[model samples]
Target: MSAELTRLAERVADLERRLSATTRTARLAYSSIEDGAIEVYDNDGTLRGSIGVQPDGTVGMVAVNAPPPPAPAPALVDSALAGLDVSWDGQWANDEDTTPLDLALVQVHMTALADEELSEETMVAALVPGGGRTGVATGTYEPMWIILVAVNTSGVAGPPSAPVQGQARRAASDDILNGAITDLQLAEAAVTEAALAAAAVGKTAIQDGAISTPHMVANSIQGDRIAVGTLDGDRITARSITGSQVIAQSLTANELAANSVTALQLAAGIVDATHIKAGSLTAGLLAADAINGKVITGSRLQTAATGRRVVVDPERAEVSIYSGIAEEMQPGGLHADVLDLGASKQAGVSLSAPSLGKGTAYLAMQSPNTTGGAGSIRLEPSDRITEPGYTYLLARQGNSTTQELIESYASAPSGGKITVQQQTSAGFTWRTGTTSATLRDGVLSVPNIAVGTARVTPVADKPTSFRVAKRLEGKEVRAFVTASTTVPGTVVEVAATDADNTGFTLWVTRTNATATNVWWLMIGSDA
Candidate 1:
């Protein structure tokens, strides 16, 4: 058996060598070879079916198939806009021609970033380290490929645009676009393209100036427009503002006295001092006509007991300068940040609203009721504020603008009026839990909290935990802008709502010692 196996192996080797040496290239139309074997050896080579005899022996060759045609190169898509600068005025409409349907444009202004800095390709590639079991198993992607996701909401509501990169955006309320490069091949193309485009013309513009002069505008037009080289020098005029006119936007000075150009305007002649000479010079507004109305000769002003202003004779002892308002409600001219609601033009008297009467507040008292002046009053937005004479005053305790509604209930243990106390930072101290400490002005009054905000819900029935009043604060930190600003302990608020007269509900967030979400508590009004 071993001898036969040796002979077979020798024969196979010989056959393979002959085939390797033999190469046939035959073409004569009619004669074609199929499933044939060739064997070559020394001049004593064995021939089976066909044989060729020649004087110098037959030179062997094999027919070689032509190489498959090469595939066409990928076409490059040329983009239209490379560099752009666009400006618009107050009034602008959609330009159907230039607006993109699915293409996303990322813009970086000169004030924000540069052009080359806008491209984010090489950076992203460097981040993706590639290698595998083999040396370069996960070969680097081609540099030219760019990836993108595009979606459209044009048919649904808003304009449809493809996102160049990942960015959250909102266009029209209903429009949305969703597109993505789902394949690696596509991503390579898209992302690279985007990087090139952004690098071409990267940054946007920075606004140079808000208001330029007439000299800056060359074209001549009527309203506020000036020809270049035409406008010169600044126009300065003296003006006075009074009454509840917002001082921030109005009066340059609180009160105009000597050298006070309050009463002078466009007449422009370098005149100084507007002397108070007559009835009710209550810091009145000086319009074009008012500046022309009064003419004064001297600087000194005098006042009589009848509240009338007269030219100072310098001999009279009544030229008193009665400064600003002096409050009667509180000393030091301060009263719990009182809101002005009066029409009296009396200087040295901080006015309070006794219900200002309409035009009467402006001129002499006309109507017996109603008034118009700047005043502070809390506002609560509602759709069910239906009571004929009731208007809710909104109060907030924390940084959030939302004022939640809380209802409270209490019952006498022995048939006495129910009273509740407010807890402060130092815990329950004197009068801290007493009703009188909170009561004010003969009513069930609220305490003057640093963050003074609350809504009183008159009780019908006491809650199950009657003694359990809340100490309010936040689980997570939230600020309260009181008169100015205060710390965590400064905030406190109460709110309540009633649908049926029978009962009400209360909602509040009770905080614990630690400022974390763990202590956030919600309680409702039982009464």
Candidate 2:
């Protein structure tokens, strides 16, 4: 019986050895995850072998004085970039300090070697069991090895906007923060630039329409102007600009500056007849003739040939010195110049008449009595033309210097010798000779008038006494005084202002009554 028991015990021990061998092989094949480096023991977990990462990056098993298991077949560790997890080798794990820091360093070296082909991005993660978590930080590795791990403690999050119900909330938060920081910096810089100019507005910020009120006379402008502003005349000089108004006193004293008022403003004042001092007494005031003051209207002034200019509108422009028309002042002696705007359109004095030539007819003249009326511009035969007007020259009919003036007159039916009145200007004279035509101003002017025959006998160098009567409009006049003698071939006319007579002739019925003997008497209402 003892022999039989010994044999059975040997068989039992042999079966136990086989079972242990199978278990050890199975364990070596099992995948090990680690906090840093993981180690796996054989059956009964005596640590006869280890399935842990080495510094050489190979799994090492310390073969003690014991039978060796078969060499491990090539293993395919279930390495996945996603969901990497690690834990300590639980059975015989040492304290965290027992692990050498060099072990982690070696693992980091191995990890760097494996990712050499990779850029720094993939190599940034340590390669060890704990490379999936924190290498060598917490626990075991074949009692020596460690690992570097960058574990993701934060789970998946997205961009930010605080809705909490979107896909990329966290990522959006990061982007928005970066953009807002840039914008805030720019706004800060702009605000810093604006606050320094404290004394006044730096420039004109035209918000809408410009303010049109008058500017303060003393202030300097920040920007452009609707109108000009200035200190009073005591401060500075100024150029005249339009739309500027003046408030100070006379320019000649210590008033507004010279030429300081704008031309446009002055034009307005002129039309309104507003009184204004022109400029300084000594220097810059307007000349006497410069300003078009109160609408002054008269004829062109006649120069006295000595003194000042005068108004000479003799025809249409009337200058009544008191109540009646002044006779002498005329247009031709001195020419018209310088205009003030008319009170009416007729205010500008105009003198126009229809005449034959281009000679200037300045002042129209009239005597007190006429066959027509006061306005009738006429000259009678008995009346003489005088100065400022009639001059005699040798006959040159076409020359403008010898202006031919034809004044008309008629004989008084009562035998008034045709009256030719003289104009009132000084230093001139005119008379009619005993002829129907006379040489005047380079022309033989046949006056448009008929004269009564002088009741003188036609005998040679003789006199015949006859009664000559003068009448005007059927009224007789005692015109002729005595018997007149005439030379042969003379055109004689009676000179009288008497209106007491019947129709007259050279002879009422002569003893020798021929057409030449019986004279023709001029009869008209002028008579």
Candidate 3:
């Protein structure tokens, strides 16, 4: 068995040597082939295929396939907006007739920017050769933006067209535009509220009072438009303020002045339940005897669902009457701080009102029914009114100018009425208020410093002088001719001289002789 195995091993070694010899021969055959030529053969030496280098430097092999090379990319097109100019307002143009380049411009790309940065692009067809310049309207106000790029037939976008800052054609103001002015005609921020002049507005500017219901836009005049306190009696014309003018329940108690509204001012049959808001009118809002048995009628009282009408309670009525009487007795209806008067301070004598603030007071009358009453109440300062240091009384007749009658800190007997007087044709008649001193012959007997102003007619002569009714002390006199009947450019001068406690004299001089008027004012302590 060993001899047989050795024989098999020898056979195997022989086969290996033969295989090596065959590989060497194949390598030799492969190396001996001609330049760029290759041929494959079967075991029997029959030709199967051939391989050689072609003229193109590619290795050509029989029965071998290869993918074709990829196609080259197309070149970019050119763009040019030749002869660009502003043809009209918000429009631009390019010279289409001038054919500088052979390529036809199929389409043109336009890029516009405002403020030189923000940009918008648009595409437009190029007009044929010899056609009117290819134009485009920006449809906007003069834009200062540069057209970033414009492209043409070559398909290449050209550089920005010479930094064209477009300007819109301005319409000649001197010429008659004939067309109605539209918002487009105005520039941005034009026609602003601050730009409008005061004289441009107002009633005078409006023809035939056009600033009325038909002209005014609804909800245009808001509350802020009307200055506070401007909508008073004087500003609002008679019968001008209608029911629609007032807001629903907007008029509060504080807004309504005492006795400002009267029956004459109110429209007849307009004071019904529908007109007045619920819970708006209260008893405190009414005057002392605003509503009485005669004032209240069957139609005035509202009837409930059960047909029962509202009635005032006797207890409430009595309380209101007593409260009103107490308020009137108080000095100026102002609540005063209680002073430590020891036992001398009377219990029922002290009078005050909680609604009256310290620094303010109500003008009250001791006996309103008595036109010329003996009892008078003067205003007294409370602890809160300490800044002023002293109290003052201001008196004014119906539509007459208000005058500071008295200023003092002198106290009077507790609960004793202070006697005051109002100027009357007969003489100074006793009224419902107090002064620093008593009155005599229609004037205060005490040293009364008063300010008097009066218009004096100037004499046509050069030495024009007039005596004022009010007296002056220590030459405390001032005069000014606020208005005059003299012609324009006429110079006039007025002077106050010869001042005395009894009266003061006013002298005048005029450059151009003309009748004129002068006003004078004097301050003195002569009643």
RMSD of each: 36.3, 64.9, 48.4
Higher-ranked by TM-score: 1 or 3: 3
- Per-residue lDDT over 311-339 for candidate 3, one digit per residue giving the tens place of the 0 to 100 score: 23333221111123333332222222222
Candidate 2 TM-score over all chains jointly: 0.15
What order do candidates take by TM-score, descending? Answer: 3, 2, 1
lDDT of 2 by residue, 250-347 (tens): 23445557766566435544433244344424435657666456564543544443433343465644432211223323222322222322211111
lDDT of 1 by residue, 181-238 (tens): 3565364336553466545733343255643553233333343555776644444222
lDDT for model 2 comes to 0.32
Task: Indicate the residue-level lDDT of 487 in model 2.
Answer: 39
Query: Each model's TM-score?
Result: 0.14, 0.15, 0.18
Q: Relative to the unseen true structure, what is the C-alpha lDDT of residue 81 in candidate 1, on a scale of 0 to 100?
A: 23
The candidate 1 region of ten consecutive residues with least summed lDDT is: 126-135
Error of 3 at 394 (Å): 71
Global lDDT of each candidate: 0.27, 0.32, 0.43
lDDT of 1: 0.27
